[model samples]
Target: MSVVIEQPKSPRSRKAANWEKYGWMYMRASGAILLILIFGHLYVNLFVGQGIKGIDFAFVAGKWANPFWKVWDGLMLWLALIHGTNGMRTIANDYAERPMVRKVLNYTLWIVCAALIILGTLVITTFDPCIDPNASTYLPGVCAVK
Candidate 1:
């Protein structure tokens, strides 16, 4: 007599390049990058120059004024946001059993992530130093001087 065997269910089709595999790789990569970026940010903000006291609106404005910082912040923004979102997506997929509910939640997550990323990039890149120069309270010193 021949014995019968059963195959376990897969979340995805066998023929496809697995998104979960890519997501796992991304988690590792982004996590490594995040550690470096986060530590650099902490060091600069908490240990360099005047430290915490130096971190006012002017400080942020000055940092954003530089292309280097702009790029750094943009990278941090995108990587961290996507990493966090993907992590949550993993959790949601694991817990949410209903197909319709999972689909809705996942859709919401992507929409929110996209919106935030776009808005953050726009804010970082297009921020003006003279939007309201005379409004010193709202303006950083750099902006107020303009």
Candidate 2:
């Protein structure tokens, strides 16, 4: 006797948005971009400077003073946070047997991610290299008087 297997999922409707597909695509795109951003960040901070010994508050202040670095770091922060949260969401969907638990977990994950991204972006944008009390010690060029 011949047997026929039924289709697992119904065809998607044109009106409905495919969030899973979008999320999957986002993971791939963000992951590739994150690799470049992360590696470049490491190369600049570690190799271009005095290596590990050269990293300090002053180094961070100097880096944040530049708009380019601020934007780069912001991008890295936002992308990484979202990518990680999406990954966690996927895991929850896969492993969590209860629907309510999965929903709660995903909601909590996204909320935390949103909070961190907002705070991190604010830090990057509002960072004042010259805000140090010991200006000469932390950022000699910008905060110290000549």
Candidate 3:
């Protein structure tokens, strides 16, 4: 039996801007940064001080109280969301045969990502450690004074 292989199609004739190139570069860059951000987050949350046992609302509140951690977490949130969305877009482009389906899937992915990014940014920027009145008992000593 003989097997036949078809040659790939030629590139598009129009010389449009290379978005895929940029997306590929972004994936590499973001993956590297994400490695650092994820590992640092894990180290701080799981290995420092009392470790996992120390994780609580108060612990999160304490971390977000600092601007550095806030920016770090916010950056992680945005980058991860964008990176994941873009990766999924690439997959949808490859696997989805219908153009409308691909468009809908991509749009949904982007909308969800945008919403989460906005909500996450707002939370990171406007978070108040002492906002809860009923949970004061579970809060840290700092919340009592605030």
List lDDT for all candidates, in order.
Answer: 0.81, 0.82, 0.84
User: TM-score for model 1?
Assistant: 0.80
Q: Write the per-residue lDDT of candidate 1 for residues 1-146, one digit (tens) a residue.
A: 22221222335566776676678889999999999998999999999999998997778887887889898889999999999998888777777777777778889998999999999999998987667646556664455433
Tens-digit per-residue lDDT, 1-146, candidate 3: 22222222334337754567667778999999999999999999999999999998889988887799999999999999999999998888778877788879989999999999999999999989776775567665547643
Residue 20's lDDT within candidate 3 is 71
**lDDT agreement of model 3 with the native:** 0.84
If the candidates were sorted by their lDDT against the true structure, best first, what order would they fall in?
3, 2, 1
Better of 1 and 3 by lDDT: 3
Ranking by TM-score: 2, 3, 1
Model 1 worst lDDT run, 10 consecutive residues: 1-10
lDDT of 1 at 3: 23
Task: Give me the displacement of residue 102 in model 3, in angstroms.
Answer: 0.4
Model 2 clash pairs are none
Q: Pick the candidate with the highest lDDT.
A: 3
The candidate maximizing TM-score is 2
lDDT (0-100) at residue 29 of candidate 2?
97
| C-alpha lDDT of candidate 2 relative to the true structure | 0.82
Off by over 4 Å in 1: 1-15, 133-146
